[model samples]
Target: MIDAHIHLEQYDSEVSEQMLRELPSLGIEALIAVSMNLDSCIRTQKLATTYPRVVRSAYGFHPEQPLPQETELSNLLEWIEGQPREDFIAVGEIGLPYYSRAEALERGEAFDMEPYIQLLDQLLELAARLDKPVVLHAVYEDALIACDLLVKHNIQRAHFHWFKGPEEAIARMIKNGYYISFTPDILYETEIQELARRYPPELVMAETDGPWPFEGSFAGKITHPSMIRDVAAAWGALHDYNPGQAEEILTANTKRFYSL
Candidate 1:
């Protein structure tokens, strides 16, 4: 099965190399390596070039970090614009800073969400112009804003990875025919499992979001693309489907979404 979203660039070089070698045996096919920033995009592109059959890159800024300066933003946009169309699969790992702003507010720090919203709007505009699918990081209230921007730009091919939000947002996404990916947490997190139950089988896929760890049965282990097999297992269990069948459905959904 393919990992619908991962930060392969974040993994240690030796570790990633070893994992790539093991993928065939693991029944793992390809990874959608989403970028965190310009540097991350560069690294991801290199990995994709090195293993073109295994690593597919997605270029965009992650929202958890501070907003970029004007020069930085311009540079990133230009860089993404210059990349060959086939070089990256989507505009990804981009959205409002929901977790960051929530943490800051709880600590009595002031946080402005508008700039992040504008940033996402610009990135969504780029994705629309390029006619590429989007991999989003938006969750909770931020997801509502993301849905609005997606509609504003008529960006229909959206994949909300490791998503969590209210029923309203979920209904909107389902209605819009957007896709969603399940992480390994579906094995243990009730919230994630509930989402698995809600999303349509054809509109859903599996991911590791790797180089970032997971808890439950995944606790303390290095995240790996092969773990998505377990994610499919858990998701299938939720809907009373067996593991092999689950993996096949998710794999097809991923291929259909990314045009892999």
Candidate 2:
């Protein structure tokens, strides 16, 4: 099994190394380590280089970070432009945070879609030019809006990890052939389970959203790539497939969606 999305940068170097070493024993063959900041992009890319076959990377600014300054954005664009085409599997973990804390939102300390939209628009253009898929972080109507933008740009390959949105929005995403990834929450989240059931198996994949623990079995625990098997188990239960069969289908769907 593969953990389609993980935050390898969230752990310390020693911890990260230990986790990666243990992932295979837990049935995880690979991971898409996503970046949440400019520095994290570099760090994640380095990890990918170190592990090559075991760790793939997706680079982007996460929504929790403040909007980039002009020079910073330009520098990031330059770095992205010069990156070896195959080094990154996608452009991701990017989008707005609609439910951020009041103070942070007011202080503009958090990423604001209003300002970052232009940056994301540029990213979409870049993704289109590079022929890479995008991993999105927006949820609810925000996810719908991101989908609208992707469609408007004719960017066909997009993945929404840990998705939570209205039925209409989800249907639109399905209609557009966008893929939605599930997380360990499937073990206890009835809403997510229903969502898994609503979407066809082919359009769904499982992820751990690692370093961010889920409730129930993993409450208060740091998430790991290994937990993806738990998510797959829940998906299998929801979709009426045996565990092995569900893992296979979801794994195939993940590889197909990301062009891995």
Candidate 3:
């Protein structure tokens, strides 16, 4: 099975090495290791270089953190542009900062939405130019704006990872034939399970977002790619598919979406 999205570079060196070494026997075929920033991209690139058969990299800034400075942004974009096409599978872990903005607002910290939107605009434009798929972080009302930008760029291949939104936004994504990945959260979150029920199965994929942690059955456990098998089980139960069938379906969908 392929992990559609994860931050493999975030884990400890020893843990990551052990995980990568044991992955094949655990039934994990590959991982789409996404970047959190330029440094993160470098680490992911190195990991991919070492595990050529098991890791595909995606280079882009994650929006939950502080926005990048002008030089930083330019450097990241230029670096991505300079890389060979096969170095990365997509431009991602990028989008509007909904959760971060909301947290700031609650803290009574004045927030600027325009700059984040502009940054996403720049990133999406880059993705379009590169002719690669996008892994979006947009959710809630932010997803609506993201949908608009995606259409503006005429980007046909996009993945909304760990997505949750209102009916309108979900419908918009579906209309565009965009894909969405379910994390291990689907095992315990009714909201996530309902999302699985609402979305077209063919457009669905399974992921663990590993090393980020989870709760319930996954509580206190270091997230791992193999956790996606449990995600497949839960999701398959919703669609009346057995465990093996679910894994096959999710693996196929991920391979097709990422052109693996």
Candidate 4:
């Protein structure tokens, strides 16, 4: 199994190292460590350098930050362009947030998304120029808008991780051949389960979105790559497949999507 999205930087170095060491035993073959800030991007790249086979990375500024001024945005773009592309797998963990609180927004706290929409457009241009896929993090109407940008840029390779869109947007995504990943949330999120049911198995994959476990079953718990098994199990139950078969299909889907 693969944990398609994780933040190794969120954990301390020693603890993150220990976790990586345990992943093989836990059935995680590879993990895509997503960066949420510039500093984390550097750290994520370093981690991937040290554990090349176990970890890969993605680079992008998260939407949580307020939109940078023009000068700052240009500096960020230059910095991203200067990074070693081979050290990363894609450009992602980028998109808008629909329900940010006022305080969060004031603190540059909540996800405003306007800046991210601009960022997405630039990232898509970058992806097209570099010929790489992107991992998107938006839900509902936001996801639809992101897909629209992808279409506009003709950037066909994209992964909409932990999707939470309405049926109409989901239909549009499927029509566009955009892939979606299901996290362990499937155990509790009927919406996620319905998404699993609506999409073809070949286009569907599983992720743990590690460091964040599902509620009820594992409240206040830290999730890991190994828990993808549980996600696969839930998906199997929803799709009426044997556990092994479901894992095989999802594993294949993930591999093909990430080109792992």
Candidate 5:
């Protein structure tokens, strides 16, 4: 099975090295290591080089964090493209700011949507140019606008990771043939279970988003890629499929989406 979206570079070096060595034994065949910033993108690239097939990099700025300087964003785009295209699988963990927008408002900080949209547009253009899939962080009300951008760019290969949105957005995603990935939250989150039930297995995959931590049974435990096993199990339960079958379908979906 594959962990569809995770920040492997965020883990401690010693810890991540050991985890990467242990992943295959735990039934995890690959991970899409999504980046948060330029530094993260670089580290993810090196990790991908080191781990080869086990760790694939996805380069992009995360919207939940502070907006990156225009020059920095430009440099990242250049750096990613300058590298061998095979070094990365997609452009992502990128999208509009939703949770951060609220936090900025509460702090009286200016939150500009223009820069966010501009950044997303550039990333989408890069993905379209490279013919690579995208792993999105877009959710809830923000999902509608993200969908519009995907349509605008004519980028059909998009994965809305850990997605939670209104029925209309979900319908749009289904109609667009976009993919969705569920994190370990599916084990205890009723809303996520409903999403797994609503989205067909053919267009769904599993992820840990590891080192981001999680609640429920995952609380207090070191979030690891191995946890995707439990995620797949929960996903199977929602769809009335067994764990083994879920792994087969999800693995195929992940490979097809990222061309793994």
Candidate 6:
């Protein structure tokens, strides 16, 4: 099975090494290691290199964090351009701001979106130029803007990871044939279950977003790639499929989406 999205670099060295050691035992075939910034991109690349088949790197600045300096962004782009094409799977963990913006506003902190939109444009342009799939972090109104930008750029292979939006936006994503992933939250979150039921299986994938944690049955557990199997089970139950069959379908969707 494939963990379609995760931050393998976020874990401590001991945990990371342990997880790597257990990959085969857990039945996890591969992981799409999504980056949060230039440092994360570098670390993810190193992990992929060390673990080869166990990790596929995806480089991008995560949208929730403070935007990077122009020089930093330029360096990151240069680094991406210099890498072997087969080493990275996509340009991802990138999108317009949402949750973080809300939190900042609630705290009366200054929140600006102009820079974020600009960054998203540059990332999308890179993805289009590279002809690679994109993993998005856009949600709610941000999702609407992201959809518009994707359409404008004519990017056909996009993955809206852990997506959440109104029905209309969800419909648009389905119509556009974009992929969306469900997390372990689906095991207990009614909304996630409904989302799995609504989105077509071919366009659906599973992820643990490991080391980020989760609630319900996943509460108090250090998130792991192995948790994705439970997500697949939830997807199966929601979609009226055999759990193993759902896992196979999700694995196929992830492989094709990332061209693994």
Question: Backbone clashes in each candidate structure, one number apiece?
Answer: 0, 0, 0, 2, 0, 0
> lDDT tens digits, residues 16-120, model 5?
999999987887888889999889998998899898999999988899887888798889889878878878889888998899898889999888888888889
Give stretches of model 2 more than 4 Å off.
101-113
Q: What would the TM-scores of all predictions be?
A: 0.99, 0.94, 0.99, 0.91, 0.97, 0.98
Each model's lDDT: 0.93, 0.84, 0.94, 0.80, 0.89, 0.91
Cα deviation of 232, candidate 5, in Å: 0.7
RMSD of each: 0.7, 2.2, 0.7, 2.7, 1.2, 1.0
Pairs clashing in candidate 2? none
Candidate 2 structure quality by residue, lDDT tens digits, 1-260: 88889898888888889998998778888898899867888999899999997899898888756678888877777787789988898988787766663456688775445776676788787788888899988788887778878987898888999999998899899899888899988888889988988987888888988788678989888787878888888899887888899889989998898777
Query: In candidate 2, residue 42 scores what lDDT?
Result: 93
Which 10 consecutive positions of candidate 2 have the poorest summed lDDT? Answer: 96-105
Query: In candidate 4, which residue pairs get closer than 3 Å at backbone N, Cα or C atoms, i.e. clash?
Result: 104-109, 104-110
Candidate 5 — which residues are off by over 4 angstroms? 107-110
Question: Which regions of candidate 1 are displaced past 4 Å?
Answer: none
